[model samples]
Target chain A: MSQTDIASRLGWVAVDWGTSNLRLWAMDADDGILARAESDLGLNKINDGGFETVLRDLVAGWLPDTLSDDNSISVIVCGMAGAKQGWCEAPYATVPARPETLAAGAVKPVLKQAGLDVHILPGLCQVDDPDVMRGEETQLVGFMADHPDFAGWVCLPGTHSKWARIANGTISGFRTYMSGEVFALLSQQSILRHSMQGADDAAAFENAIRHISVKPKELLHCLFGIRAGGLVSPDGQQAGAGAAILSGYVIGSEIADIMARLGRDESIALIGAGKLASLYRQALHVHDFDAEIIDAESATLGGLRRAHAALTKS
Target chain B: MSQTDIASRLGWVAVDWGTSNLRLWAMDADDGILARAESDLGLNKINDGGFETVLRDLVAGWLPDTLSDDNSISVIVCGMAGAKQGWCEAPYATVPARPETLAAGAVKPVLKQAGLDVHILPGLCQVDDPDVMRGEETQLVGFMADHPDFAGWVCLPGTHSKWARIANGTISGFRTYMSGEVFALLSQQSILRHSMQGADDAAAFENAIRHISVKPKELLHCLFGIRAGGLVSPDGQQAGAGAAILSGYVIGSEIADIMARLGRDESIALIGAGKLASLYRQALHVHDFDAEIIDAESATLGGLRRAHAALTKS
Candidate 1:
């Protein structure tokens, strides 16, 4: 749609501003998508006072020419943009709390943009074990909106993967793992990098996941094996085996750890898309736990819309 | 001693040429140290056909006035200098084999230096488990020279830490862990780097070791905690606590894995020096395993001398 059409039809904007990237979606009165935008200007890239400018530039085409509080567009944001180091600090809401209620803890940064009423949603924190999640909370809120009576485990795999527990429309607790980040570091910078120059093999990946799932203590040893395997075993020098093994080992260990802590009896809702989500689904299947794959983008958008609805009602 | 006196008294040279540095000891016929020299020209730094020149430059003063094959100085070298990528290819000696027999597999790299007869020692490998070590074998040989009949487990802690099973003067098997490398990457390159900005705390280190030792499955989670602890727990942000926890956790996990695999009954000889050795000792003590701390330099030198003695006899 053209700028004038979008400006006339647009009701509000939904955003998921994370550590490395920013995403925005324009929505109509009935939560119908009007347009979409994104930027590499994540929380880490933006300077102290640059967030407002970046946001303004990205959404410049979608904004109406006139400016007033009464005609302001509601801008609901969820993720690291709400962090202490973000555009405006949105203090975390401690759990055993309802995801919908997170909208109430949202904070607004004073802006010179006359027609932009921005609300940055709060994250969730667990005091007992000391864990926190920013954007994933919004995903959870979105997931909960679709399955209001959903009570099980929600696994969101990424750089800092989070496994959250939801029961009776409330998130009980969650734990984060650095599996994805560690995998990238080990395969890119560490000695294991040499061995990882191959295409990913599914069988190798599955075998690694299973092996680590059973003998989690052998993690460090197995990591060295990736490099050693190339030197000593002929098959290990194959095109994609090493990369597969590394991916499998890291993901498997994460699953094994969560299973050990929370038990495997509970159903898992794997929230992610693309290869990572598929890998997690495959790994969970190896452990005899069938996980239902949930689309991450949908969850983010749904959660933002729900939060916006809550804010409007309040 | 003067160069003239040292050259007159010098019998043979013992060298430990590892990946990052090279150390040379001028010894008399009776194995008495006459003089010592070192260089940063390790295997990794030297280009093709550069080893002989680097070695010659470092030991020029030790060479006698007259040069001939009969009067040439015997140069016994160990470590990565013998690998396929090193100065010359010295094929690995597979276990269950004696460390002293390592010299029997040593390969001589042809050199134009008239007064230098260079012999590079072979490393040890475990074909079954697919693991390899180069310089550490020399340390084991030196250690075995002192405790010939000693039969137990030997722990060599460094970049690639090795745990070997020694019985009847032979290394039956061994496993390598990239704990030190992992710790370095996580603390320096990973997100955890921000949290690891304090002095070493012994108590926090020990606590992390103990925690991971028992709950080894939580390795990834605990690693994330080092960062999260800083954010949520006030004490986590305390100086040195994060560093201590990271160190303790990594070391503890290594010790825990070795214990789980080998059982905690056998005696452990911790072969290292300085802070790393001390930390390992403290960690072992926490597990009720009293490891005998052996000076690493002595072990390396001793091992070189023993290998040299074997070479001379052959």
Candidate 2:
């Protein structure tokens, strides 16, 4: 849609602002996306007073000229922008939190910019349980919207991976794993970087997953083995195998931990996309667990749209 | 001792050239230290052809003035400087390798310098096993020399921590854990750094060790708990506790792996010193394992001295 058409049709805006990036979608009354926009100004990049400016700059072209002076466009946001150190603190809604009712716990920060009614959605936290997640709650909520009666484990794999227990339409509990962070630190920053510099090797990855699943205690030993493997592994095969093995060890450990916590009987709903998703799927197959892959982008959009619709209806 | 006295008494030189630093000791026939020297120029710091130059620069003052022209001082070297990428490749002496007999595997490289006969000692490697150690082999040799009848698990803790199975006076097989590297990367490079900055907390460290022992599979989950724990832990306590917990998790996992490989019944000889050694001892106590602490510096010195004596005798 053209900017002019979006300007006229834009009744509300939906956003998913995270640590490193901000994504926005302008929507009409019928839930159609009139226009879409994004900014690299994630919470980490924007100062306390700079959120309003960044948001306005991104959506300024979507405002209709005929709108009255006092009229405001509703904007719904999720993710890190709601954290304590973010634009405005949106205190976490403790679990078991109904995904649909997240809007009730939302906070509306006072904005200097006119013609904008913004509601920042709250993240989820388990008080006594040792887990916390910001933007992932929105994705979980969106996943629930797509499958209302879904009740099982939902795995959101990323920088700090999350595994949530969804019962009915509410999130009962969740756990976070440092798998992605571990993988990144070890592969790129640790001594393993020299050996782990290459494309993925599926067979090596699967072999690692299988090895870790059977002997989880050897995880640390297996990590050092990468360096030794690099030293001994003949020329061309070393780099790719090293990287793939590292990935498998990290991801496999996470899977092993989750299985230990919540048994391996149930199938997991993997809320991820691209290479990471494929890797997780392959890992799950190696561990003998069935997984249904769900695109994270759509889940984020779906959650934001669902939240926006709910807020507008009220 | 004065340079002249050291020069007159020096019969041979002993050096431990590792990845980050080079340590040398001027020794007499009776193993009395004549002089000591060190350099920051480790194998990683120097180029292929630069090893001899750096060694000569460090020990040039120790050469005797009365020595005839073309007479060379025998310098016995150990550690990473003898690796494939170091001064010259010192082929690994595969296990079961007798620590006292490491001199048999020594590789001599012709030096450009006139007054130096440098012999690089080979490190120990378990060819079919997934482990290798360079400098630690010398320490193990010294430890074995000090305890001839000792036959058990010997741990040399550092960046790449090694656990060797010593039988009689020979290293049977061994394994390496990236415990120190994991702790360094997580506490310094990963996001956990912020929470893991302060003086050591003994209580937190022991608590993490005990927790991981019972639930070894929850290792990754406990790692994430550190981040969440940081968020909730009261101010002032977070940093130390986070550091301690990270230390516990990394060290705990290593201990857990080693215990899993070798039963928990056998005692472990911890070849380490300083704060890291103390922490490992505490971790061992928490895990119900008896650890006999040995001074690392003394062990390295002893190993180098023993190797030098053996070479001179041969």
Q: Which candidate's TM-score is highest?
A: 1
Tell me the spans in candidate 1 whose CA falls farther than 4 Å from its real position: A235-240, A263-265, B235-239, B263-265
How many angstroms is residue A290 displaced in model 2 relative to the true structure, after the best TM-score fit?
2.9
Q: In angstroms, how far off is A216's CA in candidate 1?
A: 1.3
Residue pairs with backbone overlap in model 2: none
RMSD of 1: 1.6
Clash count per candidate: 2, 0
For residues B1-314, write the lDDT of model 1, one tens digit per residue: 99999888889999999999999999999999989898888888999999999988888898779868887888999999998899998988999878666989989998875778888999988777678999998898888889878777899999889988887788888889889999999999999999887787878888888899888878888898888777776564344588889988888888898878664456789899999989999998897888899998889999989888888888
Expressed between 0 and 1, the share of native interface contacts present in candidate 2 is 0.66
User: Tens-digit lDDT track for model 2 on A1-314?
Assistant: 77888888888888899999999988897877878788889988987599999998999999887554378898999999998889899988888999666878889989885689899999987756456888899999889888887767899999888999887688888988889999999888888888876777898899888888878878899998888776654463445589899999999988887777664345489998899988998898886777899988789878888888788778
Model 2 C-alpha lDDT per residue in residues B51-121, reported as the tens digit of each score: 98898888889988655436768888989988888988988888888865588889898766567888899
